[model samples]
Target chain A: MKPLPRIVSVLSAALIIAAAIGFLDAAYLAAKYFTGGPIACSVLDGCDTVTKSAYAVPAGIPVAVLGVMFYASVLVLALVFRERRSVTIARLLAIAGAIGFLASVWLVSVQVFILDALCLYCILSAGSSTAIFILGIAVWRLAVARANASDAAGHDSTAGRLPAVGNK
Target chain B: MSKSSIAILGVVVLAAAGLVYLGIAADGGPAAGGQAAIMTAEDHVKGNREAMVVLVEYSDFQCPACAAYYPLVKKIAEDYANDVAIVYRHFPLQQHRQAVAAAQAAEAAANQGRFWEMHDMLFEHQGEWSGNANAAELFAGYAAAIGLDGDQYRRDVEASAGRDRAQEDFQSGRAAGVNATPTFFLNGQRIVGPQSYSEFAALLDEAIAQNR
Candidate 1:
């Protein structure tokens, strides 16, 4: 029931918000993709171009659906592990964040080089994923620092205990 | 911010700037060949026949974006009547159930020498028939309104040649790397989207100046 460390709380909060934003952005695109509706793009007037590009759907699956799944998983993980005193959650988040960031980079490049257009929703998802990745890194560092502090405290009874399964 | 955070920020900024630069650069340059061969004498063309600036559009009638660009396209054809020629090609997306039918209708109307009228009517009344279950019937009404023989128009709309003509346009668009409605090729250079008239005018003006 104890409150999480300041860094952990901040990072967890940031990650959750970012993931939520990513989920909404991707979900909206996916809905429009399936329903054959027009995408409203303000930043760049190429939402339709980018969404209708060959790269938009891979293996008969809309990329926006994959994005929705990715953001949903990250959001769940962040919520469940927010107050955990272990590095496992942070490491998992970092890995997921890295994957999302890399995917965003690839998709954005497709929009740029191949499609020659920009979609505001796609950009929003990319920006949110990038923010989550950065926060994940910070969270990982904080978890490592906490673990190190615990180790240096020796057998001190007041020191925080690491989860037995994720002690590594 | 931490040094690591600052470094991450710098990397992101660099990457974003690089992407923006690449996007702009990619949008430049003339589009590849093959489009010229696709245009036949039968294609629907508007404006000056000998215009230096030729704008080819691969569009879907049922596409909202295409509808949005309809007036702008008409304006471009009007404003640059002497300097530009606009060619229409069909690129119906599979997702829109009415797109192919609409394309066939347009082609059917073309069989009676009313392609442009039907084209304008379809786009102007897109909202009325976009999701209708009987789009073909709606198209028949449009044909009648445009003064075409309704019976012949209906028969042509259902004919294989009408479908074939639309398919031909789709194939040509695919070959030209058109993946979306309202994709424009200005002077054989690709420009995507229902972009503003000013943007199109600016590019057209530049191309005209360069050609001169």
Candidate 2:
């Protein structure tokens, strides 16, 4: 089997790591929300306030649960498509990342303005989502580049050149 | 990096900056052009009316955070009985299915001069009725438990007066930049969420000292 391109491997690694961070951050918040315990805030000292705020839950569902689901989905997709250079998978990653990014934007805004409190865990989760989104965009670009390179090489030589397309 | 990579980085930076700006703009502080109205005699009051410090809370009864802060806030009121005045306002969020109903129940109780009793009962038993399909029935039970006239309570719950009162509080909250509960205005400065009693006491102390 051909080895993965350096760029794809790096991007996949970053995405997985970022998604894992997001999942853990969200999981902690979900646990705190359900168990009725205070969230320990080291940096900003408002995790409890922000997490317990009205905006913390949307549509009666915990935002942390939603965050967990989002990160878990992204993690699964990244692993499932690890071996293949599927453009569809790349697009899916981009879409998921974009959604997470936008959500981070809204949540951060709520923390800054409405809640008047900053949650360290929330900020960490937002950072992870932002990282995943940036990586997702890079991966998509890489996929597009590979596709273009393959088309230029044509069908006969494309298979042989596939592994080398995105390495440089 | 390639030119395309540079371009992507530029776009990312711009997007991040834009989002940060939006977040700052969205910060729900008092709206532009008008100051929120001050609490009046019509508002429900707890503790000493002659207190130098006034802490007005805009709360949704069904909010879990509000329930969590209930004991802490009640304790504060007790501790600063003579030094601070606590005012309760209804700001039922649209999200909580039972919030408005609970607010109305408290309003209904207000008519019978038992608002604080109902408020305490609702927050204490919040988990029991917050998600129940028969929340209205549960609230009615609470009204009766708090010594309100049953028939009068039921009628007031359905009355526009209760709803209108809640709406007025919500509008004032919005006008004052309240985006979440349980939001507290300590002498007109906003403090959001469940804060420690010590923190609250400190703020209260500061207000008292400032007044001196």
Candidate 3:
């Protein structure tokens, strides 16, 4: 088997963690909707209010479900494009993740400051997604630099060998 | 090592350390405080296991604010089930017409040994029955749907026993300095409004440690 590139390994791990966070987020919401498991919250009525709120779902789908989809897509992209053509895709994924994560943070802030409650699962998902975005950007940058250096070296070697001309 | 390589390693280590910190902080660790009485009916028999944190929730069934906070409270209950016992008092605002009846319905459900379940149901279906014309009958139907004896539930509701319980909850909430719905007393430290899980976790851990 060919050795995996260092950048691919790092990004893959980050993506997996992001996916796990998404899974947990989905589980928490589903449990509330389906089962009567006491939600884990620290604020008063925090879990119930946030989970049952309209914002809990975007476009009629649970936000947790969307989180899962987003994380899974990132993970899939990281795995499929690993090393080769990975940097560009990874950077794009990171940028998208950052936007999504920021949006979630904004929602959580509203839930706290405006709605006056805290949803533990939502917080968890937001934190994890933020970390994933950070890591994805870092890894992508590293991959790009490596690719650039190699390209530069290929040119240098070709340029170093001047065409031999017979002395006239 | 190259400067860039060092930076990469630093980022990886920092990320790893952060995850570890989060994991350790998942439950109350060194800063774990004593939680207030959050015992379920079953755990009530275990004697007053004085909780280190006391959470006071002022709620009105008809109020959208209270409905919004339902999930947040549930999360706290699950996250710190053994350590925290929340005291749910009622604070029915005047603006909501059916708030009183809904509160009463919840108390009636408590009589049937299903207060929490009915509490969740009330919040979840707040829009469906809170201020509707058929609120009384609709709420009664919910009690039945949740497996409470319909006849007994109806009698208690009509007799105002549920209403009395709700009033008592309201009185207690007022005494606790709650001017709004969903106020929290984390170890007797009062905080108002909604909070994030990370924020809660940090505060809760601090209380736990202090109590310990």
Candidate 4:
């Protein structure tokens, strides 16, 4: 029932900011896809090759759409944890972050190895996704620490009492 | 999730949905709003010159990306010979010191019924004369190889006769919203440049089908 650690609140705020950036970057690309208008590739080097490639829109859905979904969930998850301070919420964020981090790794590899080109906007979204993963872990760790501290306090106060079994 | 958590999530979801809607609406989706002038008898066209599905490219010869796109465009011209009319216009950028000169060379070659040949040679060997100070001489060599009157080609280059034509294409390209090399407009609507032959073919096929 006690309030979660201050660090959790701080990290949740960080997650929200990171996720918002990722969301915006992804949203812009999705909009570009919907518009399907003139795409000017750089004269000598850059994004048009990557974006216009087949890999960019797998199954007719822009990869940015997937990014939007991931980041929006992160943004909402972080916001919820900030207000509710629920351990379940913290765990969810940590899981989401881990998934996002792995996905970014794969996305970057595609840009470098398979596509052999880097898109500035795609890189920006990747950075934000990585940030969300890190911040999520920080909040989840703090929540676990707080729960452990409270349990320790309870044990010291009630020396003869048996702890409840199952589900820690 | 608690009531407050659910409420916050719902609010954020609604906000994201609203943002996406605005993004799409603001972009106005794809519409046929090409400012590039329609190709006519004066324009340099290849393939079915009278076809309804015309693919016009505003391109710079010295640009590496345009060079990269050269082969792809060549393939498209061949594959869609019956359905698409391929038009190439000069969009020589100022930054590439020799872009205007290269465009001029093509124009000179055009006077001899060899513009596309010069266009192909320039792009195929872009790396050779890209920044060469003797670019005009290199172009003259191309003029000879393509079997043009070498003497007249030299005179055309020296007099800047081809420059006037390059300038017209440049002006029209600017009007058409071409700010980069290799900008393609299919049926007066801009379409993303394809990365490969199949991608371009697919686009051409779609356009051809629509034209019918």
The number of the candidate with the highest lDDT is 4
The residue pairs found clashing in candidate 1 are none
lDDT tens readout by residue for model 3, B59-173: 6776666665677667777787766656666677654567788878877887788777788889999768754689888887888889999988888777766677677666655
DockQ per candidate:
0.07, 0.08, 0.05, 0.18
Best to worst by DockQ, what's the order? 4, 2, 1, 3
Evaluation by lDDT, superior candidate among 1 and 4: 4
User: For model 4, how big is the iRMS in angstroms?
Assistant: 6.2
Which pairs, if any, clash in model 4?
Answer: none
CAPRI level of candidate 1: incorrect
For residues B1-212, write the lDDT of model 2, one tens digit per residue: 34543453355335444644543444344323123336588889899887778888878887666777789889998998988889998878765667788889999999999999999999899768866789999898888888889999988999999889999988887887766677778777775333488877888888889986
Error of 1 at B202 (Å): 2.5
lDDT by residue (B1-212, candidate 1, tens digit) is 33533454355335444644544454433465367433468779999867787888888887666777889889999999999878998877765678789988988889899999999999899878877887778899999999999888878888899778888888888888666577778787776433578987898899889878
Q: Give per-model CA RMSD.
A: 11.4, 10.1, 15.3, 8.5
Q: For residue A31, give model 4's deviation from the true position in Å.
A: 6.0
In candidate 2, which residue ranges exceed 4 Å CA deviation? A1-156, A160-168, B21-37, B192-194
Query: What's the C-alpha lDDT at position A9 in model 1?
Result: 69
True-vs-predicted CA distance for residue A57, candidate 4, Å = 6.0
TM-score of chain A of 3: 0.72
Give model 3's TM-score versus the native structure.
0.44
Write the candidate numbers in order of decreasing TM-score.
2, 1, 4, 3
Where model 4 places Cα greater than 4 Å from the true spot, the runs are: A1-5, A24-54, A57-62, A155-168, B1-11, B26-35, B38-55, B59-72, B75-174, B179-182, B185-212
True contacts kept of 4: 0.31
Candidate 3: stretches off by over 4 Å = A1-168, B1-50
